[model samples]
Target chain A: AQSVTQPDIHITVSEGASLELRCNYSYGATPYLFWYVQSPGQGLQLLLKYFSGDTLVQGIKGFEAEFKRSQSSFNLRKPSVHWSDAAEYFCAVGPLMDSSYKLIFGSGTRLLVRP
Target chain B: DAGVTQSPTHLIKTRGQQVTLRCSPKSGHDTVSWYQQALGQGPQFIFQYYEEEERQRGNFPDRFSGHQFPNYSSELNVNALLLGDSALYLCASSLWGQTSLDTQYFGPGTRLTVL
Candidate 1:
């Protein structure tokens, strides 16, 4: 079975500080990894995804993730955090061969940016 | 192009009642997948529909069913809903038939509450 783990349940950082959300996945083979963000009472927004090729994938909203297959990790990072960037973050894994993939997600990490 | 959209943004139902949520995939997307997101948790895969047929399913019970129309829109039907079934149901759209990989665009999601 495939699964994702986001060890951080909650993280608070000052505005303009660096941010990193760790994610680790368990899959038998190479898996499709993704990061998604959700604001309060809003639908989820895709931050970044890694299918293949580049280990470093850049996404919208000034976010980027590095996929380290050997470590079985795909951690999301941002150079500087903004107050509006506070939200819930999720890491997901899916099948590599299938286009209509079923996503397995982690428990999620809540980010709180402070002034 | 318009992004994926879900109807009945919020729904309230009693235990043992039945509810149906609808989703319209993004333009040019042929596959629709459903997910259940509990409060304070990440989303879990429910199933995926492509070409009006279910291509993949998660560990959900048979009480959860769905249908995809010829126009590529979809619906999620939950019968004999329990209080535990209360969650935000998300609909994601992706292009099928690709052996390699693709991104699944998500909708705003429908919030269901069971009393």
Candidate 2:
């Protein structure tokens, strides 16, 4: 079955420190990968997506993710952490079907930024 | 353009009761998808509706049903709700065409509490 795995349930980063969140997926074909961030009690915002072509995709809020096909991973990274960046991050994979496309999401990783 | 929107930011219900959640898609988006996000977990795809039809669905039971309107709005209905059914219901909208890739935009979820 197709699924996404975000191994880290929670991560803590000091302010201004570099950050990396790992993700892995299981799918039959080249999957469409996506990263989304959700603030508490708010809707999810798209961080980035990998459809085709480039392995490295840039997203909002200075976040980027590299899609490694061989490893079945798409890890999200940020150069520096901000207090506002603390939120729940999810990794998702979507494989298009005949008439519909739905996302398969990982459990999610919550980030905590320390001052 | 207006973003995707959902109604009733929060709800409290009892077991065996039914609930209906509404969603209005983002401008120009033609497909609506519903997801259930439990506490501390990623959102699980429930179903997707397009052109007033249920185009695709996840592993949800028959108790979970949905409908799409001509204006690109949608509704998710759950029957015989249980305690496990309590979750944050999210609505996402996207455009699915032959040449375009799916990029979903989410609405502020409805927090459901089953007691």
Candidate 3:
């Protein structure tokens, strides 16, 4: 079974500071990884995904993630944090074969940006 | 383009009651998947519908059922709801493909509360 693990339950970052949220995944084969952000009372928005090529993937909102196959990790990062960037972040893994892909998500990491 | 839409933004129902949540997929999307997000937790996959048929399902029990319409809209029905069932029901749409790299667009979830 595929699973995702986000070790950080909560992270507090000062405004303008670099931010990194770690994610580790477990899968039998090459996993399709994704990062999603959910604001309070809002739907989740896809941040980025890693399927085949470039291990480094860019997403909206000044976010990017690097997929390290050797480490089985796909960590999300931002050059600088902003107050508006505070939200819950989830890491998910999907298989690479079927169209009915189901995502196995981590418990989530809540980000708090301090001004 | 209008994103995926879910009806009844919030609803309160008593235990043992039945509730139905509706979803309209984004334009050009042919598959709809449902997820349940508990407070302080990540979303859990429920099932997916394609071509008016259930193509995949998660570990949820039979008490949770759904239907897909000819128009590509979908409905999730939960019977004999329990307090544990109170969560944000999210609807996601995607274009089914042979590979699992398909991106799923999510809608603002319907918040359900069981009293």
Candidate 4:
């Protein structure tokens, strides 16, 4: 079965510190990967996506993710953590089964920024 | 454009009742997709509509149905709702694409609380 795995349910980082959130996926073919961020009581916003070509994709709000095909991983990264950046992050994979546009998402990781 | 828009930000329904949620696709988007986001989990795809037809669907039961109008707006109807049906319902819009690589923009989502 195709699915996404976010091992960390929650992570905390101090303001101004670097942060990384791990994501792994299981799929048969080359998967379309995406990262989304959701603030409390808000809708999800697309952070970035990896379809083909470049493995390192830069997103809004100074966020970026590197897709490593060998490990089936697409980890999101930020050079400096900000208080406003604390939110829930979701990793999703789009499998090309029957040309369906459905997205299989991970359980999600909640980020907490400390002062 | 105005981006995707969903109506009735919050709703309450009882078991065995029926409910309908509406969505308006972003300004130039031609496809609309529905998703169910349970507490503490990522969103799960329900279905997608394009050109007033059901294009693709996820693993949802028949109890969940949808309709798209000529104007490219859509509605999702759930029959015989269960307590487990209580979740955040999200609506996303995208341009018609042959693959899942198309970028989907999301709405604020409707919070459904079933009793």
Candidate 5:
């Protein structure tokens, strides 16, 4: 079975400070990893994804993630944090079972940006 | 292009009642997948529909079912709903048959509350 783990349940960062959210995945084969953000009462938005190549992947909102195969980690990072960046972050591993390519997600990490 | 969209932003139902949530996939997307997100947890895969057929399913019971239309829109139906079934239902869209590696685009979820 495939699974994702986001060890941090909550993280508070001061505005303009660098941010990092750790994610670890368990998959039998090469994994399709993704990061999604969900604002309060809002739909989820894709932050970035890693399919193959370029362990370092950049996403919207000036976010980036590095996929370290050896560590089984795909951690999300931002050079500076903003108030609007506060949201729930989820890490997922996908395309596991059937052709529909279902995704398995982690519990989530809540980010709080202080002004 | 409009991203995926879900109907009935919020609903309140009693235990043993039935409810149906609808979703329209993003333009040009042929596959729709459903997920359940509890109040403080990550989303859990429910099932996926492609070409009007269920291509994959998660560990959910038969009480949860769905259908896809010729137009590529989908519906999630829950029968004899329990209080535990209360959660935000999310719909995701992706292009089927193009490449198995495509990312899923999510819609604003429908929140269901069971009393």
Candidate 6:
């Protein structure tokens, strides 16, 4: 079955530090990948998505993810971490079927930014 | 344009009760999907509706149902609510048939608590 795995349940980094969140997916065919961030008591916000073309995809809030087909991974990265960036990040893989996009999401990674 | 919106920001229901959550898609979006986000977990797809019909569903039981209207607004209904059924219900909208690659925009989500 198709599934997304976010190995890290939580990661802590100092403010202004670089951030990297790992994600791996298992799917039979090439799939659309996405990264979303959610704050406490808030809905998810789309950070980035990967379809065809360039592997490096940039999203809002200076977040970017690289799609590595060989590794079946799409990892999110940020050059500088801010306190406001302390939120839960999720990785999702979607496949189009019957004119619908059904997404399978990973458990999520919670980021804690330290001062 | 207005973003995806959900009604009843929070609701409390007792066991065996039923509850309904509403969603209005973002402007120009024609597809609506529902998801359940348990605390500390990622959002899981419940179902997707397009053209006023259910196109695809997740592994949820029949107790979970949904409907979509012509204006692209939708509702999620849950029957026989269990304590475990309490979660944040998220509504996402996108233009499915218009493009092969679509990004789902999420609403603020409805928090349902079962007592």
Steric clash count of candidate 1: 0
lDDT of 1 by residue, B44-84 (tens): 98999999999899899999999999999999999999999
* Tens digits of lDDT, candidate 6, B24-109: 99999999999999988899999999899998899999999999999989999999999999999999998987445566789999
Q: Point out where model 6 deviates above 4 Å.
A: B99-102
- Write the residue-wise lDDT of candidate 2 on A23-68 in tens digits: 9999999898889999999999999988889899999999999999
Chain B TM-score, one value per candidate, order as shown: 0.96, 0.95, 0.96, 0.95, 0.96, 0.96
Q: Which ten residues in a row have the lowest lDDT in candidate 6 chain B?
A: B96-105
- What C-alpha RMSD does candidate 4 show over the true interface residues after superposing them? 2.4
Q: Give the CA lDDT, 0 to 100, for residue A44 in model 6.
A: 86
DockQ-based class of model 4: medium
Off by over 4 Å in 3: A96-98, B98-102
Query: Which portions of model 1 show Cα errors greater than 4 Å?
Result: B99-102
DockQ of 1: 0.67
Query: What TM-score does each of the candidates earn?
Result: 0.96, 0.96, 0.96, 0.96, 0.96, 0.96
Give residue A108's error in model 2 in angstroms.
0.5
Summarize candidate 3's per-residue lDDT along B1-115 as a digit string, tens digits.
8899999999999999999999999998899999999998899999999999998898999999999999999999999999999999999999888344457899999999999
- Model 2 is docked with a DockQ of 0.63
Worst ten-residue run, lDDT, model 4 chain A?
A94-103
Q: Each candidate's lDDT (Cα)?
A: 0.92, 0.92, 0.92, 0.93, 0.93, 0.92
lDDT by residue (tens digit), candidate 3, A1-115: 6788999999999999999999999999988888999999899899998888899999999999999989999999999999999999999998544666678889999999999
Candidate no. 5 TM-score? 0.96
Candidate 1 global lDDT? 0.92
Model 2 lDDT tens row, B19-97: 9999999999999999999998899999999899998888999999999999999999999999999999999998876
For each candidate in turn, the interface RMSD (Å) is: 1.9, 2.1, 1.8, 2.4, 2.0, 1.7
